[model samples]
Target: MASELPLPLLALLFLVILPPLCSSWRPADDDDASVSRSVFPMDGDVAWVVQVSDLHISAYSPERSADLELLGTALRAIRPHLLLVTGDITDAKNQQRTTSRQDEYEWVTYKKTIDAIVGRGGIDKSRIFDIRGNHDMYGVPYRGGKLDFFSTFSVNSQLKRLSTITSILLQGDRSYQFLGIDDTMSVGIRFPANLFGHPTDKRIEAVNSELQYLTNHSNAPVTKVVFGHFPMSFTASSEKGQRYESVFTRQSISAYLCGHLHAKVSKQLWRYHEMRTTEGHKSSFWEWELGDWKDSRLMRILAIDGGAVSFIDHTLNQALQTSILITYPTDSRSMNMLESEKWSMRNDINVLVFSHQVIRSVSARVFDSYSGFKVVEEIPLQLVFSSSADRPLFHAKWNAENYRSPSPTRYWLQVFVLDSHGVKISSEQRPFSVEGKMAIPTRSWLSYLVFEVQWEDMYRVLMWSNMAFTILLLFTPKILYHFVSRSSSYQRWVMSVLTSPIQQRKSYLWLVWFLMEGTRSKPFWSCLVIYVLWLIEMPWFWGRATSEDGEIAQMYLSGWSMPFHDGGLTGNKLSNPDVLVITLPFLYLVVIPVIVLIYGLFAEKAIVCSRRSRRVEYSAGSANTLAESARLLPDAPRALLMKFSGKMVSMVIQFWGSWTRRALLLACSITAAIHLKLCSKLMSAYGMVPVALSPPLTWMPLLLLGAAAYCTKLHGD
Candidate 1:
């Protein structure tokens, strides 16, 4: 049955969806009303730098037209000396076309956009520098007609040459270096070359050469700035999962600017900062991933005068300033006083709160909600010590009695610190879940027996079933053929012969059939058994495998971990199996035809042997026997049985091949699922999965269902 939605609810949904569009519709006003502009006073020769990426321009259209117009107007007014347009300048659709008509219409449009900005007079041509992106390799083809676009443009003499992935640019007396890297879109941290048809080593070497060039040529001290299409760092993901820093540290790079990620809102900017101190230099890398020009596009203005660089964010008519603040710990105190030094049931946890401002009187309270507005007991504390530091760190401890309440439930500790004037300085809160320990269970020899029995029993049952099916597939045809080949008289005679001791002793026919069946099933079953054992022994096999310290094992197992690890598997590890899967399927198909040829040869041999035996018998005056043999030799039933048997054998072989392939695939999927499950469990066990952030484990069953679907697809195909 269909249900209708209420009008009010439908209207509410529509209203909720309309605000984003309405906000986007209104263009940015030429004012600093929403932001503080006074903080950034422009006095020096500093101009805002706006990095544009993945423009993907084409001959004037709705999206590109608007983007070009807005960017052109904004750039003309700002006039930043160092404007870096990073990658994807042109969208190359087809690679097989001729050079002149090589479908660079997008690049042509991009050029026109640039021309519109700096004008046909070429006044601003020197200010705009372009780095090669992935799409630039469309002209050159590699193996199987795949294009190596980055190399093509990178080496192109008409285009600018920096380093392979890093280049240095010197502006006036102040030097600024730019490092342009290949894409880092992969599961590992190191930059991969296949995405751009270049080797990571070669790309890195190119960057190194550029650094060498800068070192040899430049005489003045330089503030290095790296430029790339991909962000060097990312959050909510692993560090070894992407290239977070420059490959080399020869140059003193201050900031890294990238443009792959588009900004959604005007005021929001993603800023990641890291500090590094070494023998020669102490520096910080500020990664500024510029927003897409189409949406929330803002330029960065850097003013350098008297050996100092100040970064400012600006639109066409307004600008904003940013600053860095640090906080640290001051002193430690307890909320509730305890009689003894150590509590019997629980341990006390000290809360250290670091803030940017000065703090005075502090209060510790037990709270109902996470915010701690409704306090259970407000414990006051005097300031034992104070410090004037960029990062002011403070501490408070929670005693066991403070958490002991009549409610018999989980509670949270909230600590608030105020300044001398009683204004709220800093606050910190943490939730604690309470649970009672249970008695440990006793273990005996029966437990070990039960565990072993379950696995062994299952293994034996599956193995026996597999062997039985294999034997039935092999010998059922031979038995039927033997019965059908003999006439009624011959059958009776054979039965009489079988009763004779000498004849029964010479009956090696059954032994031959047994050998043939064994030959067919043994190899297949052995392989299957080995694979099953491997599946069962997965944990032990992986437990002994070692990777670099702090390196995620799943990444290495899945063939996506960094090559920098001491014992990590590399790209070659993945390529070998991928090649085998692609090439072996055809080899298996060829083997089927060879098997058919062998079967035909055996059938011909049997025919020849029977004819030779009958000829000898006829020559020896056994004419009656020969005539009877001839009459019975047509073997209509045996021929039909043989045909049926061949068909069944073929079907069994096909099914076995399909099932084996499917089993391999299923094993892979199961391994992945187990890895993911273990990772989830580890996160939960370590309390890294926050209570507020963690979702229910309800999706686990769905994942299992999806794995089943994948297995079905593997077998069905």
Candidate 2:
């Protein structure tokens, strides 16, 4: 029995660390996300394209939909070669309910906005393409809005739609070829119910069939981009998507564009070094997710010039008539910019950066990749390669050679630009591989040793596993003793322990209480101890962590927020540390009493089972469900289960339920307010809702507390 518990307890402990293990590593910002280099086309025909997604049009707000119209009107003047809408054109989520899956009004609003995105600007409707998002499916928790999404675009006859289009400019050359995927799924009332990627096998086959056709067509556009609603990580989590990516690696694609995670952009780049059969080899594409227009008003401008692809983030100014085209380092995206500090002093690495707004200041920051990303040198880029009176060009030279390294140093150049308008923006993480005493990677595209897993990372995992198993191993003996020890034997043991007649009766009774009920009662005090521990741990965790955890990182609404890693939830989720704090108090509140009730109900069965092993045969009528003693449940475990469940339920109702109706209502109202506040924080962090809205709502819990106290004083009936 003791052996039995170690395995289960070890399993339980394993569950404890699983959150951080499988978690999606979320970077706080673009600078934090840039450990790897951006992948680009080495050579290709030039084309300028604009990609936007996750409209989430609210029917209640025409001004919200008007922003999309304003962007379309402005883009017509810029005349980008292609315009693409990835997914979630409609906001199906009910306005008030966090638990709501979708509704119809948002769908109708999206239908109108889609029209606005492709209005009369010489932008053809054929050039625009869209696919279904998880919100479009709206199949989680509620199924009423499943068909509502299709009404926005009535072209689809089947549930799933697939489309491939190639656009050509005046010269009749292949501009850009786009492949659209309808990858959507739904379940119910689960964290992963809607967010977990579940691609059907048939859909995978159809997508593969299309890719095969593109593979055969040599005249196909060299710049290939696949537009899907879900991010690559989400898709790969599915069985169908795994098969699709496997086939996709063989097919040379420039980029995989997606936009389910709005208000944020994530880029993941990887290189294939396999010497496998295929005409196309040695190419990589970065999956770029654009922010949402509904709240963020952000769009992406992808420019393909011959052999290079550069992306610029554009913010739509609703107050102004035209869109604001933001600019940064555009020239150095393709070249071997990764140079050693030794080489930098010998030969200057020229960086060309231009912005639409008036210049303020520019500085170059060099980060050491080897030494835990320590800033080896920070130099203000004073050497202006060129100056402009009307438009300011930002340029800076760093003394890279001054900080030369013996080993190949992994460093990156980040240019911070301040505009005259007091707006500051950072350049994309330009991670450079400096050649040094250590061998440098020569591959044109940056590569990291993924297969050569970092032993440190593995060791950390194993260390946690061992620690958990050992901690649980410590508790196995007690659990076994509790399961086996009988009341009479326990009493005898207590009497034997009281051999010291000098011991007072009060001390004896206290000892008995400590022995029997300490485990149950200590949890109450443990909660208080945890609060103090959190105070100690907060600073330690802050200094120790590279970034805060999960949705909390994006929205630190409270001074008392605990970090929980994501990826445990389920899209990139549409998903702890204050986990022990959040969990322990509830376990004390709910589990201890439930456990005691179960033990009381099953004590009879335990004694009966123990007696069975001691040569005592249970008679058919003696132990039968119909004739067992009334002191115990006369039936099986089901009867005991029901009796204990009733006891636990009755205790809660009899005790806590004694509160007046107003107090009960106030408690429920406060709890509901807290739940909505937490949900809004996550939704805003995920870019589903406006970040501005989250701040006002973050104060809801505090307001509710004040209101509760006031109501209590008023003594409302």
Which candidate number maximizes lDDT? 2
lDDT digits (tens) for residues 575-624 of candidate 1 = 11111211122222222222222232233233333434444554455444
Model 1: weakest 10-residue lDDT segment is 30-39
Q: Once superposed on the true structure, which residue ranges of model 1 sit more than 4 Å away at CA? A: 1-48, 58-62, 91-103, 120-122, 137-168, 171-173, 179-199, 202-209, 212-219, 233-250, 264-282, 294-717
TM-score leader? 2
RMSD of each: 24.7, 18.9
What are the lDDT figures for the candidates, one per model? 0.37, 0.43
In model 2, the Cα lDDT at residue 355 comes to 42
Backbone clashes in model 2, listed as residue pairs:
43-307, 44-306, 44-307, 341-400, 341-401, 342-401, 564-576
Residue 715 of model 2, lDDT score: 17
Off by over 4 Å in 2: 1-44, 99-105, 139-146, 151-175, 186-192, 219-221, 239-245, 264-283, 319-479, 482-717
For model 1, state the Cα shift of residue 241 in Å: 13
